[model samples]
Target: MAKEFTSLGLRLHADAPHISYVFIKHHKPKEGEAEVPNALYVAGLPLGLDEVSLEAVFSVFGHVANVVLHPSKRSAAVVYESKEDVSQALQHASSGQVVDFPLPAPEGPVGLKAWVASHRAQRPGNAELQKQLDGWMEAHEAAEAAREAARQAAMAEDGWTVVVRSKGRKRAREVGGMSTVSGGIAPAAAAAARAAADAKQAKQAENFYRFQQRDRRRSELMDLRHKFEEGRKRLAALKAARHFRPN
Candidate 1:
């Protein structure tokens, strides 16, 4: 295993009189320790970030292996199946890349922060970096399991949760809270949805009836014209067949 990052930097500053801000960075990699090439560490994310949105952004390059978002820590870790995918995603959004991609938000014109995952700090010639990296992998797995459990618990007994995906971001914004009685959704939103559906059906039915009426009227008109034409032809035939009679 070759060291992925050669340097590590962590600093805390008092951004405000009573608030402290922490900044983290990775600089160098050690010898023989393979870099954590498949994972990405994201920071300064917007509130209510989710795995699907992250995938929609990064999976364009390749398959996303996994995503672990630390809500408490206000950061997230994204893993990819291939190094190329990681590079592609990073190139699209990394602040340190040659062509940096700033992941802009929809509501505001602000870019999301993103970078490649780095192992824990170690001495210049120590082999302990691998141990730390292995620990990180274990922790990530545990966090992911916990997140999935929480999501399941939040849903109704039917294991179904309905969400409307916004055009801006694919985040599932719940229109209304769950329905306690039916264990589905709120009554008001459901009613609105039902009403909208009914209106659409009514409109379609009206159009269909109008079409049917038009076709029936046209058919009747054609039949009347045909009858008149046939009667005229019969009268002409009778006149021609009869002897020339004086009235």
Candidate 2:
């Protein structure tokens, strides 16, 4: 710290109870220049005061180069283009009364009255909202149509003919000398189905052969029984007619 200071006013509130002043005193002449040139430390700035307003306030004395405000501390450091403006500001600060600076009207409407008027003006009418909704729906339908066209183009590249059905879901079949549908039965599944059918036919043939053999054996047994029964009857008749001799 080179021990250099400058005077500036503290405008904390309009009727602040006490007033404080900071005076710049130089004890000894230093060989080099000051650490910060043409700068004044300002305190007691009102909250919500922007840099533009601060600059405008200080620019009356000189061209304000920059203003760094600390809202929490309610203080700001103002840098002037030349040292003469610093001297002028310091002279103004030496007066006991606060500087009378004109605060510009706020950029936009503020407070409850202005806010209510702005809100009412900005509110959208029912007709406007409905028109916006209609525009959005139209855009959405156009986008869907574009996407469908692109999808059909891509499918046509792969030799597929898509059939769109109104009642059910859309299906695509292979065309241009292609045998199968795009998403139909796979080759492995087809092979498995053929194998199952062949196995079923083989089982039916085997069962038929087994049934023929069983039927033939049953018919032979029935014929032998019939012949045996007829021979017994004939022997009985012969015994009755005395044409049988015992040996």
User: Where is model 1 more than 4 Å wrong at Cα?
Assistant: 1-35, 94-247
lDDT of each: 0.55, 0.68
For model 2, how does the per-residue alpha-carbon lDDT over 102-204 read when each residue is reduced to its tens digit? 5655566654666577787887778888999999999999999999878777777787766554433335554444433334456677789999999999877
RMSD of 2: 19.8
Q: Which lDDT tens digits does candidate 1 get at residues 1-247?
A: 1233211111112231232122222212358876766776666544334676666654665898897777664666667787777666544433432211233343522223222111222252345677888899999999998896676556745666644323332333442354322134566777899999999998778647777879878999999999999999999999987967777
Task: Give the 10-residue window scoring lowest on summed lDDT in candidate 2.
Answer: 20-29
Q: After TM-score superposition, what is the CA distance of residue 82 in candidate 2 from its true location, in Å?
A: 4.7
> Backbone collision count in every prediction?
13, 0
Local distance difference test, candidate 1: 0.55
The segments of candidate 2 whose C-alpha lies over 4 angstroms from its true place after superposition are 1-34, 42-52, 60-76, 81-95, 103-107, 110-138, 153-159, 164-247
